[model samples]
Target: MPTNYYKLNLASLPDGLYNQETDVKEWLALTTTSKGSFPPDSLNRVLRMDSSVELERIIGISLWMVGNVLPFVLPLFILASILSSTGLVLLKAFLTYVAVLASLNKFIFAPMFMKRYKRKQLSNTDIKDNQYLHTERNNQKYNSLQFVWPESVNRPALNDKPVIFTAIPHGAVPLGITCYPVWSKLFNDKLCHWTCAPVVLKLPIVSSFMKHMGYIPAKAKHIVDTLTKKEENVGVVLDGIAGMFRSDKNTEIANIKQRKGIIKIALRAGVPIVPTYGFGHTSLWKIVVDPFGILEALSLKLDISLTPFFGRWGWFLGPPQRVPLCVALGEPVLCPKIDEPTQDDIDKYHSQLLQSYADLFECHKASYGWANKKLVFV
Candidate 1:
């Protein structure tokens, strides 16, 4: 048995971890006390927090605002200036302030946030005794995050070899990918280095957080170095900035028809590609579409989403919606390690990966409340 293999105990988790209306009931259906027994109430109580938990939750959301939400405020301010009577003078002032703060983010705020997060982690006294505390700690920040590993996929033997994890439908924030720590704890602490847009590493506080979280730049050389030379698992967002524009409440679009670079990277390193989908990832934000397709073009060229978006509260404000955040990992598509894979080899593996992703979605769509929805590959 692999060191990472642990019995799936859906019953042992806390109440809010899984959405009650969805497949969580079905997940726990077979585990009724009539069969054997459930975990003790004391274990559940560990996750249930006191008054301090609320404060911690607020701070977590605030930090999220700093890292994920702050960079775009200047753009919003510019738009507001155009619409409102607010003159360009005020806007220029705000722009200058934003610039100075962005510069100071790395030197001042990033270290402070990192220290606070680390301190909170160390403060969890029960972390060592109860391994599930990893998930609990992560949920402190992301309220509705969940992981569903279908029985069809084999348990990742992290000790055996490193695997490439490809996450789909990159949300406005890609919150699921940032949950790498929780994923690492499950796989016996073998960290999967996530690849992010090169621009992300240049952002103010977000870059620091990404670097602290062990994110590699989404460059071919950097990815190849992490897989081949460093011999570690790597995770990539397949659709990236393009998918952010396509995010919608009614439909799920995977902008991956043109994404074959990662496949080639996997082939070069001889690593298996795991088709991972973050269901309800798009539900976290409401994107304002550009009918003219102008924002999409600019976003691709800039390697970042310039599309106007909003969270649960309103335009670029408030925490993400409390939707059930479930990331499902599918069976791996094995590929041969070829130093110089021809176009034929790349196309073959890419096609297999596409099928794997589609199959993964079809297998577990209904469980997460997407019964009638189909994954449209653009």
Candidate 2:
């Protein structure tokens, strides 16, 4: 049975009950300037109305309805409709056509796309602003580190034999030496017939620049191809970006836990690993400390950073400390087959590479003042 309600008296209600009744005044004031009447219940009902039908109708009219209309467009539409209706064979034909177009795009259009993509990538970064200064300054100094030895010491000849040159800088170093004029001269005059295998050529912007400067991409295929043609002489950065600073009390070279793609490439190529060291790079920039670690974190996240120098110093090329750099190079560790090299072998070679780099750093630290400060790996 339905329930019934009994009426109650409101004559004894308190005046305080009407204290919050300011709505009428507000409504009256609003009505003086507008022709709208308050219809809260009606408005609520309209707002609560289901919109699913309208939404579905709009979507259907845009896509499904438009597709349905395409079949009425004469001979071409008739052929398309017939083919789609038949399925299988027609689908294969369409797929074949698409595959041909995709192949064309891959061979021709993709390279253009990559070049433009790389250009855009470089343009979006601040790598160009300080590129010349940072790269050239470090390259000049580091390259000169090789020339410092007495003529009596038997320096390795730049023969056509493939030798891996690895540069290990104590802290943030510029990445321009792989294609500097001094290196270019060395390659042209001494190692002219010898092809360089710089790992930087594998990087995006730097790779493009390296290619233009006659250094090809350091892919396994390319390295193998070059090695087959002539005995290739390659230069690789051992520490890469990791060697820039110490992390967890160990330099990036010291951290053997990560993948060393360069080491693997050298091993596969059967190239001699030569460890080169450069010091005094940390002195190039004044260290800015952020207590919160916000700025450092942001720089790393964005892959763009500033290393401010106190004053401009003329480029200085240190005498080549071959013993230190060569100590890291040690012996040429060979990996027979480029294709079948194992992960364990790669790891062992990478550990050896790190040890070589560490030895180079330790030997040259005194000369560069890097010996005093704790090498904190970031």
Candidate 3:
């Protein structure tokens, strides 16, 4: 999927012995050796998989799962054990059940879920105007103290030209998605909207609330229409469902390099790419599955990803921590229009867009308490 993984510019990085070519044989050879000492700021870890920190995240995620979801689902699981002992449909009737579920999900469920919103006056609040897309109608769920803006950086001035916010590394439902209005006010309420999974708006008894709140499914047509028709900006988690599974110990190894679909959208929709970075997102919650685990792979097939992510409940509302969430918005990178964009265009601009994140992290890591971190693009 990576057309040119070697286009990364290592020269700009501080000089040291880096496996730039990524010599796997050498890496395996050196795996057990005592790691040589390097300067403090030098790249040491790939994705911030620090044992202590990651362990804390893992424990947090486990508590949420074991304490929260497990209690509720355990009964259904136990019932399944009895039913399975009597030859149940858990595995034998998988195809039959799935086909039935799919049919219901499409025809009966989705329409009924959307009907509630249509019956209400929620649709009138669409933020398609060129003016600010956010407002002061703050949601009670958000605590302003948690999301702190970086003082070292100033918010970029937005214009009438449509902007595509490429929110990368899909770290634990980025605080922006959770506390949108406060997030908007933090940025002087620069009007912007976000996209979510189709499942979010397709569920029974739940879809109406999200639809009323202005969340759209992350479909290409919906994204294209929202960006162009409304003349408004949209913040998309570029990784979508797949990115949630891609989170790992490394805080910096993002999958965005090969995911050039955003580049194509920018080229076609005539929007500039804003490589927005949420420095502490990946570190917020510890997900307890392998990046390439069977659950992750299976989730991809279903167009949804699941993670029993866990974090401290108090931390969610408590005052900002020492390393609080600080989002950095980068300057817009203009893309050249091509009637039919080639691989060269995607690769070339994806590299440039990747560099923007590196620059953003390097420039502001210290003020945000990530001084020892290096934004490595793989």
Candidate 4:
């Protein structure tokens, strides 16, 4: 097994020597838990905080935000900063024109480009297609995020059969999930096909970027054709929109308990269902709760999250959270192919898949310092 990156504390060292007595305790307290799991009592104690973890979140989110929003935010800030001081009114007008053009590119050009890209995407086939250029790399090529998975176990290579990966506990931004395309390479690209939401493909500029990253619409026809193709693997964030609802820290809440349509699809396709979960997924956001259920109502209506959220940058979109996030994959559960699986059949396999999710978390959380996290069915 590849050794994970070590996060040891050099604070309170005995001169140049390391103390074995406090080593284990400090490692557990410092490196293992998510930011949300940090004890609140020590929150204000500046001396007790580790700068490295904080720095990662700040740096990660900064790059992500700059990449996502700089084209729109930077010009306006520059124009506003120099508008009053400028003696050249023509230069100010040019800057204003540039800002408006940027806005048009965001609001107009990008969405159309994405829709055209979607229209041109290739049909599903047994052989994997590189119809679009995706910079997403195999895990071996990605270094920014340390993705750890069980190395000792075998997944019975997805060579001859169709398979589905059911991801759980939809986090705020699912930054962890975004890295999955890179991580899924562990299972071999020949077997993986990503199913993305249609609305995500309708975003101004991001929609084009997402398609280039190999996401196809999650339509019934698309799914059926993909699965029917030899050895093609489908990845689904099975937890529906409700998974975005706020829950207690370290809770295993997933909307999976309420949503089980994947069960029927797997049964019909005769594919094995792989239960995947991300510990510390929710910690990516700072969600504002709505007591009267108004937020969830509006979110459902808009098909977007209503619970206001931000990252370290504390803006509309936050930076990468410093929280430790781990996405773990479990052994696939075989489902019998049925033309029409009754509720009992769906329920039976759903429960089994749910159990596999729980077991997967239990087996790996210790390595991720999430041993105390509960596997909530909700």
Q: Which candidate is the best by TM-score?
A: 1
lDDT of 2 by residue, 155-234 (tens): 23333355556554434333223323223223222221113334333544444544444455545666565554555455
Please give the range of 10 consecutive residues that has the lowest summed lDDT in model 2: 2-11
- Candidate 3, residues 7-51: lDDT per residue as tens digits? 111112211222123232332232221122112322212322224
Q: Put the candidates in TM-score order, highest first.
A: 1, 4, 3, 2
User: How does model 2 score by TM-score?
Assistant: 0.42
Against the true structure, what is each candidate's TM-score? Answer: 0.72, 0.42, 0.59, 0.64
Q: What do the candidate models score in CA lDDT, each in turn?
A: 0.62, 0.37, 0.49, 0.55
Error of model 1, residue 226, in angstroms: 0.7
Query: What does the lDDT come to for candidate 1?
Result: 0.62
**164: Cα error in model 1, Å:** 0.8
Off by over 4 Å in 2: 1-160, 175-212, 215-231, 245-259, 287-338, 367-378
Better of 1 and 3 by lDDT: 1
Where in model 1 is the C-alpha error above 4 Å?
1-59, 62-85, 88-142, 151-158, 247-250
Error of 4 at 227 (Å): 0.9
